[model samples]
Target: MSDRKRGSHRRVSTSPWKYVVATWFAGVLAAVGLGAVSPAGAALRSSLGLSTGELAWATSSITAVSAVLGIPAGWWIRRLGAHRALSWGLFVMSVATVAGATAGSWGMLLGSRIAEGVGYLLVFVAGPVVLTRVTRGGIRSAALALWGTCVPMGLAITAAAGGVLASRWTWNRWLALTALGPLIMAGVLTAVLPRLPRAPVQHPYRAVGAWKGALRLGAAYGSLSLVGVAVVMVLPLFLTERREVTPTAAGTLVALVCLGSAVGGLAASWLLRRGLALSSLVPLGALMPVACLPAFSAEFPLAVSGGAATLVLLVDGLLISAVFAAVPAAVSRAEDVDVANGILNQLGSVGMLMGPPVFGVAIAAAGWGAVAAATFVFGGLGTVLLLPGARTSGTGTAHGVARSLDAQDRVDVGEESEPLRKALDVSRPNRNRI
Candidate 1:
C-alpha cells in the first residue's frame, strides 16, 4: 500500500470532542436542507407551476435515492472515509440546492432534488460512524444518542424558518439562501475535521450474515421510524380536521411534539449513561406508541390530547436514540459500523417513504382512530424485530466497549490494521455480541 493509504486510517491522537461537534453541525445543515422543501412546498408549486404530484416527488426524491442506494452509499463512505465523504456530500448538497433555486420548471427542480438525495445519503451514513470512532465510552454513547435528534430538530427548525422565508421571498430565492448553509459548512468541515481512515474497498453484499443482521436491525428501526414520522406528519391535520383547532394552534402543537422528541433523545443519552439496557429501552419505546396513540385519539380536551401526543413523541424519540446507541454496541468490529449504518439508513428511507402516505390512507379510509390502530400494529412489529438483535451480548452497553478501546489506546480513528484488528479481537466482548 502507498504511504497515503497506510496513513489514511490514522486519526489525530487528541480527543475528538471538537471534531464530533463540528461533524454534527454539518450533518444538521444537510438535514435542514433535506427538510427545507416541506415548509416551502406551497411556494415551490406556485413559483414553478408544479402540480401536487410533482411537488410530492420533489420532496420524496431524497428518500427514494436513499432506499435504492443505501448499501452502496455505505461502501462509498468506507472507501472514501467519513470526513472526505461528508465534505463531498455537503458540496453536492450546496450545489444542488443552489441549482434548485434557479430552476424555472418543475422537472428542473425535481432533478436538483434527486442529486441532493445522494448527497444526503453520504452525510447521514458517514457522520455517526465518524462520531463513534472519535469519542470513547460514555462520551461515544452520549454523542451518538444526541445525534439521533438531528432529523426532528432539523425538520422543526427548517419548517419554521422556511415558513417565514416563504412568506417574504420566492421559493427559489429561499432555496438559494438555504444552500449557503451547506456551502459554508462544507468549507468548515474540509478545514477542521481530521482525515478518517479508509476501509478496504470490498462489496458489502458479499457478507451474507452481516447483511442479514443489518437488515433485521434496519426493519426494527425503520418500523419505529415509520410510526413516529407518520404521527408527527399528520398531527396538525388531525387536530385541525377532527378537533376544529385553528391552523396556527395546530402548527404550534406539532412544534411542541417535535420538541418533545428532541428532548427524548437527550433523555435516552442520560439513561445510557445510567447503564440502562437498550433491549429494555427498545421494547418500552415500541410499547409507548401502542399505548399513547389510542389514548391520544380519544375525545379528550384539546390540551389533554396535545399533551398525550407530546408524550408519544417523547417516547418515540427515546426509542430512536436507544436504537442508534445500540448500533456501535452491537457491531463486533469497528470497521462494520459503516455497513451497519448503511443498512439502517436504507431501511430508514423505506420508512420515511411509507409512513406519511400509509397514515394518510388510513385516515382517509376511517379516521384518526384508524391511524392510531395502524401505529400500534407497526410499533409492535418493530419491537418484535428489534428484540432479538437487542438481546446480543454487550448490545446494551456502549461504555463497556469504549472502556475496552480506551484500555488499548485504540480509540483514535483508523481502518483496522492487522495488529489493531487482533487487539480489537482480544478486547471485544463475547463473540455473540452481534
Candidate 2:
C-alpha cells in the first residue's frame, strides 16, 4: 500500500472507534435518562392521578414506541447515515428528557416518553450500523459489548444518583440532572461524529422485509426485556410499597442488578472466546428469574429481603446482560449480519414493549412475587426458543442454523440454490482481545 493509503486506513480505523464510543455513550445517556424515572414512577403516578394501567402504559410506552419505530429508524438511518441519525437522536432525546421533568399531566408525560422512545429507537438502530461499518474483528465485538454494557451501567448510575439527589433536592432537580446525561452525549457526538455518508433507499426496504427473522429475534428480545423490566422497574416499587424498604435500599437493589449485568457482559465476552453456543446461556438466563421467585416470595425480614433482592437481581442481571449481549452476537453469528442485526434490533423493540405491561399486570394482580413468577415463565419460553439449530459453530454460515451457532462458524444460506459463501467481510476476530 502507498504511505498515504496506509495512513488513510489507519485514520479511518481510529476515527470509527471514537464514534463507536460516542454512540455507546449515547446508550448510557438514554438509559440513565430513562432509568432515573423508574424509582419515582409511583410518585409520578400519584402526582398525575394515573390508574395502574395508565401508569403501566405511561411507563412502558417509551420502550414500546422504540420497538415499533426501530425498523423505520433503521431505514431512516440509511438515508441520513449513522452519524447524523445518531446526532439527531441525541438532540431529540435530550430535549425530550428535560421536558419530561415539567410534565404535570398523563398526556404530557406520555408525549414526552413517546419522543424519548423515538430517539431511543433511532439511536440504537444507527449506533450498531456505524460501529459495524467502521470497526472490524474483535473491535466489533468489543464495541458491541461496550454498547450493551452501557444500558445497565447507565441505569445503575442514574437510579442511584437520582435517588440520592431526590432525597435531598427536589424531583425537578433530579429530572434536570438526568437531562445532563443526554446533553453531554449530544455535545460529544457533535464534536466527534463525522458527516454521514448517504444511505441507500433499499435499507428500509430490506429491514421491513426481514419480518420473520425480526419476529423470532423480537420474541427473544421481548423475553429478555420482560424479565429485565420486571426486576428493574417493578422491584423498586415492590421493595418500597410491598416490602416496605427504604428508597435508598431499593435503589441499591436496582444497582445490584445493573452490576450483575455489567459482569455478565464481561463473562459473555469470555464465553464467546471459548466458542460456546449462545444457547448455552439461554437456560441460565431463563432460570435466574425462577431463582428469584423463591427469594421474592419468602417472608423474610427487611435486612434479609434487601440482601435477597440484591442477590436475586444480581443473578438475574447477569443472565439478562448475557441475553442482551447474546442477541447481537447471535445475530452477527448469521452470514447476513446486517439484516440479522436490523431484525434483531426491531425484535428488541417489541420485547421492550412487552416487558413493562407484563410486569405491571403481574404487580397489579398478584404483587411483586407474582411478577417474579411471571418472569420465570417468560424467561423459560425464551430458553426454549434459543435451542440450537443446525449451523456451523461461529463460522458465519449461510444456512438458517437454529442451534447455538457461534459467530465464527455461522453459515448463511442465501435465498437461492447456491453453496454458502462469506456474506459480509467483517473484521476478523482476535481471541486475545475479548
Candidate 3:
C-alpha cells in the first residue's frame, strides 16, 4: 500500500467506533422525534384547536407508516446503503419536525408526522443492519444489544427532559427543540461514518430459504411486542391508581423501571460475550412477565405490585435485547439483515399500535386483570414461535451468537439452518481498516 493509503487506513482503524456511536445516536434521535409531540400534546391540541381524535391521528400517523411499510423501508435502506439511509432518515425527521412546528392545522401536523414516520421506519430497520456492517463479532453484537435501548432511552429523554421543558415553553419551541437532535445527529453521522463497502450480495437473490429463521424471529418479536407494549403503556397508570401516587411520581417510577430495563439490555452484551446461548435467555426473560404481570395486576399490596412491575420490565428488556442481538445471526446472507429487521419492525409496529387499545379494552371489560391473561397468552405464543430457534442445545436460534469471537473458526452455517448459525464472512475489522 502507498504511504498515503496506509496512513488513511490507520486513521480509519483508530476510531471506527465513532461511526457506530453516531449511527446509534441517529436511532435514538429518530425515537425522540417520534415521541416529541407526545410530551407537549396538550399544548399542540390547544394551540392547533385539534380534537382528541386529531391529536391521536397526529401521534399515530408516523407509526402507521411503520406498520404498513417496514419491508419496503428495509428494501429502501438496502438500496440506499446504510450510511445514506441513516443520514437521509435523520434529515427527513429534522425537516418533518420543523414542518410540524409550523403546522397550524391538524391536517398539516398529521402530514408532517406521516413524513416523520417514514424517516423513523427507515432508521429503525437500518440501525441493526448498519451495526452488522460496521462492527465485528463482539463489537457488532454489543452494539446491537445497545441499540435495543434506543427506544427506552429516547423516551426517557423526552419524558424527563422534553416533558419538563415543555411546561416552560410554547409547543412550537418544544417542536423546534426536538428537531435539533436529529439534525445534529445527521451531521455527526456524515462526518463520522465513512463509506464502508457493502458485502457482495447475490443478484436475483439465491439463499431465500436461509433467511426464514430471521423472519421467524421477527414474528416472535411481534408477539413479544404485543405484550410488552401493553405492560409498558399501562404500568404508569397502574402505579398512579393502584398505589395512590401522583402522576409525576408515577412517571418518575416508570422512568426508573426503564432504567432497570436498560440494565438488563446492557447485561446481554456481557452474557453474549461469555458464550451464553441467546435462545435460553429469550424465553426465560419472557416467562417473568407471565408471572409478574398477573402478580402486579392482581389486588396485591403496593410493594408487591411495584416489585412485580419492575421485574417485568427488567426481564422483558433482557428478552427483547437478546432477540435484537440475535437478529444478525438469524440470517445466512449478510444482505438479508435489513430485510429481516424490516419484517421485525413491521410486525413490531403492528403490535405497538394494538397494545394501548388492547390494554384499554381489557381494562374496561375485565378490569386490570385482563392484561395478565393477555400476557400469559401472548408471552406463551412468543415462546412457542421462538421454539424453531430453540431446537439446538436446548437453546433458541441464537446459536450463531456468542460463537468464537476469537476468529479461530466461524461456526458452520450449514450445520443447522432452522434458526441459523450465521455465515460470519462479513467484513472483519482486521481485514480492511475502513
Q: Rate the local accuracy (lDDT) of all candidates.
A: 0.75, 0.59, 0.71
Write down the TM-score of every candidate.
0.86, 0.74, 0.84
Report the backbone clash tally of model 1: 2
Q: List the residue pairs that clash in candidate 1.
A: 9-197, 9-414
TM-score of model 2 vs. true structure = 0.74
RMSD of 2: 7.2
| Residue-level lDDT tens digits of model 3 in 331-416 | 65456677888888998888778878887887889887787777777776776766665443234233344342213123232433
By lDDT, who's the top model here?
Answer: 1
Error of 1 at 283 (Å): 3.5
Error of 2 at 395 (Å): 2.6
Off by over 4 Å in 1: 1-14, 202-205, 290-298, 393-434
Alpha carbon lDDT at 157, candidate 2? 82
Clashing pairs in 3: 279-396, 389-396, 389-397, 390-396
**Candidate 1 lDDT trough over 10 residues, lowest sum:** 425-434
Prediction RMSDs, each to the true structure: 6.7, 7.2, 6.6
Candidate 2, lDDT over the whole model: 0.59
